[model samples]
Target: MNGSMTDTKPDTKPHSPVLIGLAVMLVAFNLRPAITSVGPLLTGIVAETGLSATGAAALTTLPVLCLGLGGALGPAAIRRLGVDAGILAGIAAVLVGLLLRGFGGLPALFAGAAVAGLGIGLAGVLLPALVKRDFSRQAGRATGLYTMALCVGAGAGTGLTVPFEHALGQGWAAALALWSLPALVAVFAWAPFAKARPAAAASVARRPAPSLWREPLAWQVAGFMGLQSSLAYIQFGWLPAVLQGRGLDALDAGYLAAVAAIAQAPGALLLPTAAARARDQRGWIVGGLAAMVAAFLTLAFGPEILTVPAAIVLGFASGGCFGLGLTVIVLRARDAAGAGALSAMAQGFGYALASLGPFGFGLAHQATGGWGLPALLFSAIAVAGAICGLGAGRAQQVGQAARGP
Candidate 1:
């Protein structure tokens, strides 16, 4: 549990922290668009492809499942590619997957989603480690910035894809494909760091950290991560469709989703910093979960006039929840290696658990022929997430004394 394996040596002429932060944000920007873009366009994809409800659910679920699988690969990627190269590789995969999804037929679309999910999984898991490694002094703030960028990206993907589709005159595929451009930019921005050697590489090689798989706190963190993520991905994959079913036009629903997503930016930016400064994050976690549940209820049954406000509230609350969830990972770990390991466990198991939310929502809607069941389901998830957060929000480091055999 010592910090030797995670400490970086002071660089004689170090890269500016601001520049590194910018690079991290840029990479983070590419993470959500691949999945978010699909939600706003789901109706069209289902219509054009003649997909059944189940098939469409699978379309959204596949990438999220891949995210978990990819997260499981993060430690291996760090060992083989180093953090920088690992990120570069992840972005490249995203770019390719976006392109493939945009241009191909049904089979190609699913294939592309899997590829992109893998990339997202890999990059998502590694980014926290990079933040822990380079920004240990300001991990909370740094997590906020990147998490904000991620929210912005999610907003853009939801907001802009519709506009892009209309402008391109081709369809949803073209709009989805356009997301690859950001991935291309991220790859270039991150390439310089790919070759830079991490100072702790030697230390990491000499000492293996304890396994976190059996740690109760690690499981608590992972549960918090997965359950919150279940809500988040449900929003990403279904909120717009839910709005459309409420009689809004596709464009309006998409914009509302964008508003919710963009609203998260400020919350993502501010909450983690506040939580990090607090004695414990439990209050923040409970408040965020409460807000999210309220927003979900409002969106599900509130008046039409209240829709925008609900979206904004949902976005802000969800952003806070997500940013704090990630902040806990860093706060709970003793070092960068531990952060990487905890992140992988949380995201790997967490996202896999998350994929069920959207799929289950689709199934619930299909089974009941109403949003009531789905609304109840959302409430159940938020309540469960809160329980896990209460445990994870404690001031303690994981894997220090509770390592798995």
Candidate 2:
């Protein structure tokens, strides 16, 4: 059992870590495009489909729920197939989902979004564990690479989907479908790495069973993940609309949202690397949450002139917290198995909790007929997230915290 859990090291033969990392990066790059692309084009979708605002919100919310469900199932997939195979399967699912969403009408769109979200959920759960296993010595760097890739993909989707729709002259459907190309590319890029793993390593890659559900630290980590994700998804699903309400056009709204998403890139790349070297990440977590709260206030009632800067600040804060959330999952684990279990806990339940953000935010806006209430709510959430992060950002490992003397 010990050997199986701890023996996931790469084959003795010289295999290029660079190649595997690139494969991982490509796969990561495909994770967010399906969801992000829909947001910028949501106005056209609602206009064409006659879907209500609440219904349009489902485009973002449903996929996130599926992502949580997928993450919950990721451990099983990883156990059944090694990391490479599991992630490869996920990337393929995403491609199929994108195709379904792009070609079909409203029903197919929602279904495809859910399917793609599931794929992202499964692969997303295992990514941290893969870094912990294969790049143990440089887990921070590997995480930064993939997370940065995620930010780039998200930014591309937010920034380009509208233009793609205009360029293709095919409406939102074509724009949504265009994302499948990247997923297809990821699948091809990942296949070789998945196949290169030695047969012997497959048996050894099985994670050891750990009762992470019983751990308080694990729950704190999950709360942090869910809360931060909630804020992120809210921005994805509604930022353009909010900006439009504030007098910006759809194109400019999307560009600003793109700026916010792109801003996360630097934070995602830098925070994990920085936190990995720190004895405790509490200070970083606190500071990031502080920025989030400040940004929320500025967005809610501050002068309109400050919205751009507020969005940028919010992006940095959310991005830093997100990267730190993943980093703690790795830092809190003793081994790959532990990391896998922690990831399952953090991402699975975390996203389940997160799925409500966009949906509820939409409902609140509908009820209040404005963004004020939701903005205040988000500020409170940031505070709660900080509290959770404080506990999760502790220096000790999950097992150690759980097995208290």
Candidate 3:
């Protein structure tokens, strides 16, 4: 493993662990809503904006694309600004994006999503490193907590957007804009913790992160991140729409999506903690992929009675897979700088690759005019994720791949 970070002083200072932990949870909570909320509201947005199905897909695709692009900038920002400042900036961007989205118009909607996605990307990479740095002794548990927060946030976004729209007398823009409240709260909530960590910025700046782009294991991890993320984003962007095509109305479709999303919370809370204590995470990875495949298959051809249960299974597996991906980033790194680099590398390339999932689903649907084709494609994605996740889930670190016999 890279040893360059050893010289930096440890951060055991002004901020209590509770404050930092709360900040992490709040920030994690902000990452998904700005993006996930759009999916449930897509039908309304498309109707009002007159966007084609593919163009509407861009509402989801653009942010995900920005997520990859923005993640690439995280390490550099942290290198210059420190973790706290970097995160603060990220939260600010999210707030700004939400405001832009809420303001109205299609251009504003896309632009806002892009901006928020950039913020999410920056925040995403930093959170893992923060956990690795501050809660090293309980990285798994801490990660699980924050991961659960992420799920809850995503679940709320999926489940609540329709209701929010209804409550606002079917005001889609109003609903989309209101999600800013939580992100605004996150910014204030993160401030005290950021203020307490002035020294951490200096320490992190002193460490030179190694180049991970050349490492094969790093690519494996990136592949795992990308593949699983593709599935998750698909769920985020298209699951409701897919279900709606089956005969459900907007609210019923939203509820089904919510059930799937909320189901993820348990696995997000438990799997990473369990995986961290294990000798290897391969079994969890495989199990999660298996569940995704099953979910897809059921959605594709099973009886309607099985669909809801399958969605629950898919959510549970997805949460475990995603949580494990976050855990591996920390577990495979030797220090915060290393974790930051790995997180950037994984999320950067990974999300860039994943951004295509939603758009592709849209294209497949547009082409075949049904969910059958896309469901098969989703199964294919699950198989690919399993292969990559199996490698990423191994009991090894990224830098160690170079030194191995």
Candidate 4:
């Protein structure tokens, strides 16, 4: 396939919107499982991998950082491959990377994680565009479905990792490796779309990605996205271990952690729709921050017995807050290109910020005698998230819309 996107029209492509949408969703479901599933099984991996504290934490952060990198680079990648082929390549890369991380040991784990991150990053940038492209009339409803699927995937990955680890009594290696199966499933599910789209016959030079760093709204959107993402990644990376430290058995802690994550699917599914229907969402931002503060306070000062409900409430709010944060990106953008740039900006900052969560939580917990200080500190981060969200959620456009050349 060799030509420029400027020289071709995606309109004449043979695929239907349903086909593209489903393909995008299947790819979305695969993106998180590898990066996310390992957290619930982190203890076993640390023991098996002989990782130091930093190495243990890097398992989570490296992928997150790569997610950011992937988002930043995905647009250029798309220009080279065109949209449909680029997606297929990303899906394949993640599948291979998942296997490498799972079966190959620590170095391979890092490599696999990085590769998987790249795959996810590409998919992340591309899918949002596809949503804007194929589902222009249904962006709100479409985002809800896609975001719901994101939660379901995250939760399932978190839940299954430990169960699989416990299953063969083989520790975390096999459990961690098991996540690759879904990517394989996605590759097959998405095969039809790749088949339908004909690649261009001549290659073209990739254009420089437009700069987004100078935009004020870009920063605000990124800040809001990053702050919520930091908290969510904390849950993905450490909440299971946190609950276990409080005395639940492995299985009990896993389910409780799963309980915390389960609410995310619904919250992500519903919150953006609610926010989109309103003119001002500053109230919801403040409320989400407040709920998270309450949740952390429960973890810090409330009885240990309340961990279950605390986890659920916090998890629910995290997803909802994030869903609205994502909504803010699309709503504020002036065009599909603007939306695309903002998405990259937000995710690049968001995932890098997210990479901090697990490592910070782990270190703070390690340094202190208990979870209290870390919870308090994270409470501050959550508060910051609220402040940023409120600002970002305000009604506004990306910038002055450009007149045609």
lDDT of each: 0.87, 0.83, 0.84, 0.72
Scored against the true structure, residue 199 in model 4 reaches a CA lDDT of 45
- List the lowest-lDDT window of 10 residues for candidate 4: 200-209
Q: How accurate is candidate 1 locally (lDDT)?
A: 0.87
| 1-405: candidate 2 lDDT, tens digit per residue | 001123434553434678778888899889998888888988888899999978976777999999899999877876788777888888899999999987759989998998999999988998887787777787777787788888888888898999998899988888899999989999999887677664423653654757888889889999998898888888788888888877888999899888888878888888888988998888998898888778766765679889889888877776777788888888888877788888988999999999988888888888898988888777777788889989988888877885662
Q: How would you encode candidate 3's per-residue C-alpha lDDT over 157-256 as one tens digit per residue?
A: 9999889888987478889888999999999999876776767765775688879989887888889888888999999999888888878788888888
**Runs off by more than 4 Å, candidate 2:** 1-14, 198-204
| TM-score versus the correct structure, for each prediction | 0.95, 0.95, 0.95, 0.89
lDDT of 4 by residue, 1-405 (tens): 011123335664555556556666677778778777877777777776688776777777888888888878756665666556667878888898888866657888889889998888777766655555445556666776677777778878877777787786766767777888889989998876655554431121133334678766668778888888888877777777777776777777777777767777778777877877888677877788788778756754579888878978977887788777777777776545566667778887777787787778778877885887678767878878877876687777666322211
- Model 4 lDDT, full chain set: 0.72
Model 1 agreement with the true structure over 66-128: per-residue lDDT tens digits? 999999998888777777788889989999999998875788889999999999999999888
